[model samples]
Target chain A: MSLYRPPRTQSSEITPREVYLSRRSFMAGTAAGLAFAASGTALAAPLAATPSAYKVADKLTPKQDVTTYNNFYEFGVNKSDPAANSGDFKPTPWAIEVGGLVAKPQVIDLEKIMTEIPMEERVYRMRCVETWSMVIPWIGFPLSALLDRVEPLGSAKYVAFETVVRPAEMPGQSGFFQPLNWPYVEGLRLDEARHPLTILATGLYGETLPNQNGAPIRLVVPWKYGFKGVKSIVKITLTEKEPPTTWKNSGPSEYGFYANVNPAVDHPRWSQATERRIGEGDGLFGGRRVDTLPFNGYADEVAGLYAGMDLKKFY
Target chain B: MALPALPARLKPASVWALYALGLMPGLYAFYLGIYGGLGADPVREFEHLLGTWALRFLCAGLVITPIRDLLSVNLIAYRRALGLIAFYYVLAHFTVYLTLDRGLILTSILGDILKRPYIMLGMVGLLILIPLALTSNRWSIRRLGSRWNSLHKLAYPLLLAALLHYVLSLKSITLEPAIYIAVVTVLLGYRLVRPKLMERRRARRVTATR
Candidate 1:
């Protein structure tokens, strides 16, 4: 067996009972439709993804806190802005334009992809660069599954993801002074994109993702900072070069492309050795502070991906 | 630069009322923090609001000197209260960071202060302000005499340190922080050119008298 354990399709306590029971039925219905033609519509039916074997020992963060507090700057810059201002954002009738060095480049509809891929519930620890964390039960499938459907060319070395730019719907995007450049972009090495731990999350807590929480689709790389999980992704381009990311373009010194969570790699201005775990305590007398782990505690699974490279330099 | 003559002095009641109004934001933030009105991450919000108010008050106090010199507004009487309020906000901000953000973890706090440039800068600004806050009384002015002016000059360093702390704390230097830095640059930049302006004024006055 390989030194690194690949994710198994087994039981993890993190999965909700209702979703677990429907897994067999969900798979049985996978062949019900392949409506690639239903691409640009604005309606989304209920979604169902299987419960994946990957999970964390930590308890789930309160769904209220998870949904209410977010970093989706497309809606707004403040943590609460996404939740408050995302009311007008329509995440449905969504389709991701997958192209660039691919055998089958197509505009994959949210519904079509939902039928083609087997979604799984993975409980992962999301560590933000701002030194805050949450253990979330995310419902989605490995990003490799999507990449596989596209059949990336051998020349493709990186996978660049772009969030949708609906300025009319997203207030943050419509404003004259945007906190970030429009169509916020993120990228990952092709190998990293194929890793089992990296998923494009669709829903959370056994429900459709809220608009503020990157509804319809968002990338989730457990080992990297939360920003790497680009939200409301509309464009996925397999590239021959490392693509420029939003944060890196905005602040090169403070934010790097890799953005892997390393306790040793301090963000020029702040320490990353510790983080406040949201919903861990009553948030009364004091907060629940915990030591930040390398690779966000997925080191055993992903550390090999960065084997000899200095995390401090990449970070 | 022409302006109407202002009142010789503001009534103490008016200054007292200004003090109450000035403190509303910080206090309201604290009230909302405890009541769950500040949203999911109330702890961070509370801490941020206090830090912002502290910096704002420090800037307000700094403005008095410039306004007096440039605009002929002798609002210096309110400067002491603004500095004291700024010191209070800083104290509250640190308390929230220690209790809510750090959970009173000594090791974590020490690590942050030692390793984080932003945290260290904030602490230095806090330390400098404490001496100024304590000496804001009339007694310090009577006793220190000329030394009092030199001691209060520490406000300049405190202002720089506070702005750096604010700028460094953010992940990206967004527009809000950029505006703060710009405002501060102008405030400090004015000091550099003030001597020349004052020299010109002196020459004009001498010629007019002659």
Candidate 2:
């Protein structure tokens, strides 16, 4: 036989490195597909921050509208479940502990947290990882305001939050195998922590925080999946390393620590490029899908943070 | 002494044909819901309609064996198809509750399960059906044999679970679930007492003839 090599593969053409990289990308793409399958709904419209800048609004959302929505599981499964079960959680006498690598570590009560920070009303679109989204006029102050009080040490690189845990009160906590720990935990990179979109939210639609909606205090990271914004906070820790997060601990590949709500990145099991907005009623887009936004369309404010990084690899 | 098999058309397609037609009403209800259909409470209407279909199909599936045995007709072929159809509607019923009603929230669903006995029973009913659905095939039939019969016997417990789920889910213990419970108990009791009664009757007839 003649010493002829395969035409498609030259001695230098399909290198092993190229094959490895392609395989890695394929695996990553599959993982994104899985994530999308787990959660995919309509992309929500971003609500504008009102000029009035009131600490609270008359009605953040209509009463009928409030009952027709949601996807927070720690609070419960039904859209109206959190609205009902959340009422049982006591928000009074709630305290926020600030410590760990912080120069000015101190504990602040709920009243002080609001007084120390100026509350602005922002109507931001809340998109769940599972794809359904809603536009809510949230009443809260920027996270930067709270960090200012903590005064992190030079070594502090990440900020961690812990949700209040009361298994007796929160029946969901009865099962030990709950993917998340008794209290929900979430974290942010130091720079991401300082972003303006990061709000330490208190109320929605111009009223006191509803129990189902993370009443006493919660984080609102507009660019990330809803879970990144932990609810019912009891502790805040500044650490040299990234903190353990609920989703990441449960399934690392499915829920990255960043958990940025990027439509471009497929979530392993489903496509993230589009979503279905629930309860809008039918017509052109009624019960239909809509295109997803990059960084949930807050790219103008948060895109620069990941400028030099390769998202596909980091994702 | 037996006649040769008749052609497909001559063999009664009446029951099968009627069952096939029953699917249209559900599809129509779903279609109506889809196209500006159920007015104010579309979600609730859809839920009610689908839940009804689940129960109806379940009762229909249960009745197949009794009718077949009493009439000495071939319903074994229809049983698999009917049982699967029952599963399909029930799956749809559960899905609407999860995605539409529950919004797919894990923490919240877990909470409801803990607080509501009705929700817990409904979930148990749903979970018990999983294996039956998995094994409802000829391949499994041949492979499993007597074990298959034993496993498929779970339909009795499943039906009870379903009735309990339904009764608990209702705001009041109305005439509907009570009727279903009565009917299903009689059916299961029939299955249990059937063979012994037939044996005693056969013995009495032989003694009388002698």
Candidate 3:
């Protein structure tokens, strides 16, 4: 019973009662009118946004592909499983527990976080480790905005993320032979988390996120592989040591801790030199393969963060 | 061991029925691919479906001999049909890879086959299956006579190459491919051990008669 209770935090006093109440009402007003559609349904309410410098110039992947085709293995392993299997996933009334090595670790309600942070539309090229890529126009605020509110201590070197593991709702977790270890975990260096390009995306295509595409809230680290952007995150832990990621723990040789999109370092199974654009093709057989870019074409903005470290070794 | 006689009525009717049934998966794959039913990356999905069915049909073809020997089920009439369907699937799989996936770019396709081990293994499987498919008809069987049996034994090696190709192509070791491999092993093991068991049975029969 205690585990279900929200964790108490020192930052509870930071928000004055009046301000908190007013912001809650504002969020409720804006989000209440939006239709919570199932997978493949159009999201009608357009989130307010300003154009971001991080936006990629490439053509946006078809919204259908973005929502229908996903790797949310918590739902299922097939690319279509997330869309087909996630209809019953309950995302509302969710809270993200931001704890570990922080001055004011707090459980931020999803509604409060949405209203407090201003949304920006960033068109980022999402590169999967499987050599498929998509350009998505994600609607959300920068991860740094949330991290700034949490106030990470100096000792915190890495920021860890954990996805929700509701076996009853997410059928993949309940299956006899699970594809991945439960509670899919991912991590990023403290600096990566604070980067302006890293975002806690709430929606895409001018609509609240579809359940298949990590409804309610998810992370989007543009320069890293898609798996690094963990979905439906329930916990954020700031730690001194690197966190154990699900893929890295599953296959250390194939999935690295720093899963930066580097075409030079190929995956153990396939070459990362080229990627098939998911929605570029005709209905049947027209997709084209393009050469993959270094750091997924975001090298200028995020490459310096790696500095002198060998990318191949880290990858 | 004596070969069980097939039911007299089960010849041409069952052959055509099984042939139509075997094509259902490919037809369904096409239906899904063309109608927006296949999810994002339809080409990849279509390609995977074709490859998967090819491997499955190959396994099915290989399993027939063992089923006949052990269970006295005379499915020998449909074995050739199953193999031809598998070959058709393999061709379709390669066509998807070459035309749709790599866009018929000779250099890229050749380069991928040369560089990537999985593609190389897949090609090896295709190469081994070509003669078996071409000679699948009665004319070649009649012309070659006894040598036909020796030539068609190539299916054994073809299955090995196809199974390995399937295993190597995956992103990670998942249960699906592991199950395929396990099934393939059991089928191949039965084929390997059947001859010895049959020979021992024949020896025992001769001694008892003497």
C-alpha lDDT of residue B102 in model 1: 81
Q: Please give, for residues B60-165, the per-residue lDDT of candidate 1 as tens digits.
A: 9989978988888777778998999999999999998888888777987898899888899999999999999999999999999999999998998999999999
Q: Give candidate 2 misplaced runs (Cα > 4 Å).
A: A1-68, A175-179, A282-285, B1-210
lDDT of 1: 0.84
Residue A230 error, candidate 2, Å: 0.6
Predict model 3's lDDT versus the native: 0.84
**What are the clashing pairs of model 3?**
A281-A287
Q: TM-score for all predictions?
A: 0.87, 0.57, 0.87
Return whichever of 1 and 2 wins on DockQ.
1
In terms of docking quality, how is candidate 3 classified? medium
- For candidate 1, what is the DockQ-based docking class? acceptable
Top DockQ model: 3
Q: Report clashes for each candidate as comma-separated counts.
A: 2, 32, 1
Against the true two-chain complex, what DockQ does each candidate achieve? 0.39, 0.05, 0.53
Question: Between candidates 1 and 3, which one is better according to DockQ?
Answer: 3
Interface RMS for model 1: 2.0
* Model 1 ranges with Cα > 4 A deviation: A1-46, B1-10
